[model samples]
Target: MKVSKEQSDANRAALVKAASKLFREKGIDGVGVAEISKEAGLTHGALYAHFPSKSALAAEALALGLELANKKLYGKSADEAPDLDAFLDYYLSTRQRDNLGGHCAMAASASEIGRQDEDVSASFTEGYLEMVRAFENHVAQARPELDSSSRGLALVAALIGGVAMARATQKSNPALSKKVLQGMRELVDEAGGLGKK
Candidate 1:
């Protein structure tokens, strides 16, 4: 029996979504084609039909993860924050840090993308740039007078780095996570204050 177009699309989507989550949680090298197929409840051969190879799937999955992260981090408008304090609090909360299921894909996988082939690296690069754009948008809205891509890039780097560090030390030193997050909060606050001049 031949599958309808809708069915085919849904099957492919399943592989994409499953692979995205696996890529974030397990890294590109950590997950295999068979594992992705199994998670999606499709036969391993079905994966090849949808994605040219695991490398292609890695690219797609990275995009999917970053898209989800964008939605989660920047989904709110400036109206949501009464001040920068609230904004930073919501931005670096443990809820976003610990929940890979709904967090940014770049946070979960960018560090490891360097290990993948060129195709995978390109996907990560594109995704990382997009994430930076999203961050720039938020920073602009938060402080319109002081706009600079360099500042935005630094903020994104600090946010990603802080969150990652917080997670890494959470098991051994829970206080370290909060300290790292608080340090970033102060940095953004100081920058915002300086922008007023």
Candidate 2:
């Protein structure tokens, strides 16, 4: 009749994980609490036990997604610098483009975030700013001449926009989708001064 602390924590994690994946694959509005509970192998009542509402769960899920994406982009450790060129290569590839449920959260839900509640928007904004800070720090070290803040903002925007556009057109215009990815890659590389010695 009772649950252990460890079990409760695990259940909460499962709920957030399931919500993150499902939200990315299907927009937040498109998914229901029952589906997320089923995906997590928990009951609908269990979801409410951890989260007050679906929006609360969504906020937590988006935060988790962003954290995971950041770790994937930059390495796990904060001291290590991100390889901009390598990052571009992987991010722009069709593999990432086609992986809707596992790719960046920003790209997957950029259009939908504006319609969500403040908590969701706050999570999205914080995640986005964290990304910009990572880029800014990298630019400061790699190219002192360039404005780190400006370049950082630009690179993040380009990356998110690039992926979003590529995915959007992938079904209707495959060639254009490919071109969008390619163009954004070039733009990011040039803006970052990626390959210069």
Candidate 3:
């Protein structure tokens, strides 16, 4: 049967969505195009029609997930914030950490990114810089008097690192996850008061 254009588009989206979940759950190397196609409810050939290679699928899925996360976590950049403290609080919240696909591309896929080939790594790098830009924008707006560039770098580095540490401790000690988040949150408070690291 000939598939409608709408159906074809849906299939392509399904493949990316399914691959996004799988890539988050398992490292990119741990999955194959055949597996992703199966998960998407399409044949492997159909999968190739949308994405020529597994790396292509991974890159697209990673980009999609990051775009979704920026909207979900930070909302519009126009409604900017200088409130690094509030951003830290929300970024490290329980809800944010618990939602794997919904939370962040980097936090969910950083380990996989390191293991990936250069193409995927390049995608990851680009997405990470976009995140940094957004964070820096907020920091600069929130505190024009402060050194916004360094503060932005510190804030983003600390939050993402906290998320990574929390994820690592999830199975071993769930309590530690909260502690790491809380510690990072307090770091903002500490920095707000002192010009210290």
Candidate 4:
């Protein structure tokens, strides 16, 4: 039977959405095409009809998840920051760390993507750079005195590192996790206050 174009699009979207959340919650290697198809409520055969390979599916899903996150954090354009502090609070929060499936895809899956094929890595790198560039532009606006490029890179690293470390220690040592969040927040606050002085 020939599937309608609408149905085909919906199925592809559902697969990407399910794969995005699952890929974040579990590393790329942790979830397979079968599990993603099952979660998306589509058959394994249906999944193949949409994607040629698991890597292809993963690359698209990663891009979708990162795009969603960038939209949430930075709005429609990279330069617009409706609420910078709010972004910092949510990003560095324990809640965000605990909810890996709903937070930063890079922090969750960068290590796994690093091990994947060139295409997958390139897809992730593109989104990752876009996100960092957004931060760079935001920092340039807020702190004209400082080197925005280096600061943006540092801020992105600290944000991802803080969240990753917090999640890692959330179970073994909750205090350390909290400290990671607090430290990053403090550093961000300091950076924000720099050009004002």
Best by TM-score: 2
Sum up the clashes in candidate 2: 0
Candidates sorted by lDDT, best first: 2, 4, 3, 1
Estimated TM-score for each candidate? 0.82, 0.94, 0.82, 0.91
Model 2 misplacement above 4 A: 195-197
Q: Give the Cα lDDT of each candidate.
A: 0.74, 0.90, 0.75, 0.84
* Predicted candidate 2 versus true structure: per-residue lDDT over 1-197, tens digit per residue: 89999999999999999999999999999999999999999999999999999999999999999999888778777788776667778878999999988989999998999999999999999999988887788788778899999999989988999899999999999999999998987787677766324
Error of 2 at 85 (Å): 1.7
lDDT comparison, 2 vs 3, better candidate: 2
Tens digits of lDDT, candidate 4, 1-197:
99999999999999999999999999889998889999999999999999999999999999998888777778766555545667777778788889989999988986687689988898888877876786787778877888988888777777787788889889999998899889888887787542213
Q: What is the C-alpha RMSD of each candidate to the true structure, in Å?
A: 3.7, 1.5, 3.5, 2.3
Worst 10 residues of 4 by lDDT: 188-197
Candidate 1 runs further than 4 Å off:
76-87, 137-147, 192-197
What is the per-residue lDDT of model 3 for residues 95-179, given as tens digits with 9 covering 90 to 100? 7887765677778777668777787888787777766676666556556687877876776667677897887887789898889
Native-referenced Cα lDDT, model 2: 0.90
Model 4 CA deviation exceeding 4 Å by range: 76-79, 192-197
